[model samples]
Target: MERGLTGRYEVTRTAEEAVRAFVPNPLPPEPPLDLSGERQRLLEQALLACGRLDGVSALLPDPDLFLYAYVRREAVLSSQIEGTQSSLSDLLLFELDEAPGVPFDDVVEVSNYVAALEHGMNRLREGFPISNRLLREMHEKLLARGRGVDKLPGEFRQTQNWIGGTRPGNAHYVPPPPADLADCMASLERFIHSDPKPFPDLINAALTHVQFETIHPFLDGNGRVGRLLIALMLHDAKVLRQPLLYLSLYFKQHRAEYYRLLDRVRQEGDWEAWLEFFLEGVTQTAGGAVETAHRLLALFQEDRNRLQDLGRSAANTLRIFNALCSRPIATIRDLEATTGVSYPTASKAIETLSELGIVRELTGRQRDRVYAYDRYLALLNEGTEPL
Candidate 1:
């Protein structure tokens, strides 16, 4: 299925020199994707994994408790792919306004990702269509703070942009010129809202992801925005009850291969190869999420069982413990406000959990100590090691 140079390139003049910027052909690549045999098997496996992930949502006693931490984990991993060194703990620490040694720019970028994602999910839940407008809104939140604040947050690039090079003249891949960006994105919008989609939702997501990367819509944060689109698309199509199937970990694991496949789709019309890779990512990531959910559930139960052994203090400790399950990292004041316990009770409960090794103090200060649910954070920290 070599469609020979997937899109036409036009020579454009950059301030440095003349460069050939590529304008990609609209969605539904020509000679349609070959979905027979192995591809079909992969698709089925991905769908089955998704079904299991959807089932996981219903099984959790409080899915939001899991989502609260899981989404932050995703935020860390996703921003890590974009060269941010912000770890999950850095984000949690930043959220509490106690960021000391953490990189402010990196943590702020990651925090913005969390906010952007929350905004997108909320809008989707409010029955908003996944269109260019929503993408802009999410993009606005994404670059609203820190380093990317100057990158034209919510708007498409009005100037040429390139990827991986010193300048546009020597860039690895130059996206379409500014003049063509609007039309390119509009075409993408139509495909998103197409009445009879040419491909199934998952397949469409894979296709849309590649197209978004190719288009390179925004001046900055294109990579993060494109990845966010995948979760939004899956949730919109009802593939998952929650926005849980994040491919950042998988993509981060297979970084080179992921980029190579995206290039192959444009260089050679090898949609099947990319589709296979995307499906594997879907299945692997979804399955990993389900396993994480189960582990969290078991850990919750095991810790709750331990709380029962607290004797007379178990009743009050349980309230604080439940609150920690959602926040994982909290100040005594936060614990008091959330659990509605007095400051003394909150302090005593956290001290008890610290003795039990269920929670550990993040800051050594005796006055404004912050506690971390150590085991819980460790579970979510898996595979999020900085690159």
Candidate 2:
């Protein structure tokens, strides 16, 4: 066994030992990857479900609206894993104006994290190769604002890190020592950019995720970082046009099972079962996202038609409505910034929308009042229920 230290904590490991030695047994059954005949049919059905989500997402009046919503959802989910109580609505409402007790700076950091992920996704869409540098950049964006003291933002671990538990003293698994960090990172880089072997992209994603988790490269934010890698890798592999499939909800819901399955792979080389769980997560999460997108689109179209019937100014109404779609909460300042209108014009647009019942005032304060795209936030929140 190899022994090392991170500060005062001790980490011990061996090359041939179980990947997660502290995790117990009774691993789940391995799943099969051969999607021939009936299996192939199931795979097609899952892809079709994902396609429907993309179609519905395309119906948004402004694609940036959906993109913004996605960023909030990603932040909320990533925060949840770390025991942060922020919700999808919290993120949306905070964007309009800072909330009491909630750190505005942290919110900005989270927004940038989401933006970095979106930027990475865009690069991947344009066929850019995934690199260690890209992952570090994303991590830096994610941890830009220090969450608390002693946790440096955006920097990698100078000491060793572990998984399966919170503190090093209580960790269930200690990965390769710092002396082996180079080999561990090289393995991860190979997994990311290397040619695909016999495994399907989804299966490969699950394996890569486990490997990254095992590596535990960062001091904090490993869980969130690992999840982000899943979305990016899937986009890079062309499995989805957008980084829309978020499995954190799935992982959080089945926390024990998730960890168990991951440990099973390292202990028993049980790739099949992990692949099945991942594929199932994709199918279910994709379906939920599709439903949510459809509902949001329907709501948008209905509201647009309503405004048109009222003989509203098409250009201004469309601009305000589109801004609300992207950001569920908005202020006159936001409307002015988005629509490039005078403050008075922006106020008039918001008042008109409020009168039309398309937007509702969230806060009663006269100055810097917040307006909510209730329907849009509802649809986005529907898919994200805390476990």
Candidate 3:
């Protein structure tokens, strides 16, 4: 077993003790209710907007703003948990492969975090069980690039880590010692695999998230990995098809209250209050994501129509435009491969877009120039940073 920071304490807690320790205090007294009429109407509006996003012929509003915000939020949340500092601007440039002065390793970590999230979501879509094996796979991906970290990649921690402080010596909360970790993890695995007491999916998510945090299973990447598990569980429960909902913003916004709620759950068994908080987060975050998706779809449609109006080569233009949605930055080489056009033809199509003010040259150099879907990126970045 690994030692604590002072080397004076060893981790030890039974799985049952661990669960009892982290459960919210003052368990909520009431069950979660269906959305009220007004809230239901709002959800319907959000769904309608999302539907427009899915429809091929629907007009799209500026979606890049929302995309940018979502991407930034993910970066910030994932990085914060791992103690990596990155700004929205830094994340934006990193995503574009234009970030300067940032270490390549840091960029790789961020990318891997995003990829893990996407992978988990895709697996959920295929209806795979959120097994311990799956969690290990994700953990492995998270730590695959670290140089010398002793915490085994893709495995539960055999050591102890603390939360809410710079060092374990000074941490506000010291989780169960390492000796107890195995039992704690086993109990969690049981919860995931078997139905326990009846609970709403949202409540189950909150309980699972809290328990994972308490377990702090991995020596590193526990916070990010735990949060990712929340999204995975939500999808597995059929709450959403995409890993689009994020609670980071809510937690970030209510940082103190978030922790307090968790503490209260453990101290008072207040599962009811915690469940309410979680459901509100769900309803709010989902509503916002739906809005963003609609906005993005609208922007895409408008751009498509603009290209159509230009009377550009219909097939070539559509191909290039759709490619930009997936890849905001592109080179002539990229276009040629994506469109199956000769280099010269690809260059011509790019020139046509440039002439029509649809694409902008991101790199001023004439040779091996890079073009950007500036508006699209901008839309994706919106509300991602503090105003």
The root-mean-square deviation over C-alpha atoms between each candidate and the true structure, in angstroms, is 0.9, 5.9, 7.2
lDDT string, candidate 3, 108-154, tens digits: 67666776776666676677778777787787887777441457888
Task: At residue 146, give the lDDT of candidate 3.
Answer: 46
lDDT of 2 by residue, 189-286 (tens): 76556554545666667777877776677777778888888888777777776668788877877889988876666656665566667777788888
List candidate 1 segments past 4 Å from native.
none
RMSD of 2: 5.9
lDDT of 1 by residue, 1-387 (tens): 577678889898999689999999998888777899999999999999999999998888998887888899999999999999988988998989987456799999999999999999999999999999999999999999999989999999899999988999988899999999999999999998898988889999999999999999899999999999999999999999889888999999999999998888888879888999999999999999999999999999999998897788899999999999999889999999998999999888988998989999977886888899999999999999889
Backbone clash pairs in model 3 (N, Cα, C under 3 Å; residues 3+ apart or in different chains), count: 43
* Best candidate, TM-score: 1
Q: Quote each prediction's TM-score.
A: 0.99, 0.82, 0.76
Summing lDDT over every window of 10 consecutive residues in candidate 3, give the lowest-scoring window: 1-10
Rank all candidate structures by their lDDT, best first, as comma-separated numbers: 1, 2, 3
Clashing pairs in 1: none
Residue 97 of model 3: what lDDT? 63
Minimum summed lDDT over a 10-residue window in model 2 is located at 1-10
Highest lDDT: which candidate? 1
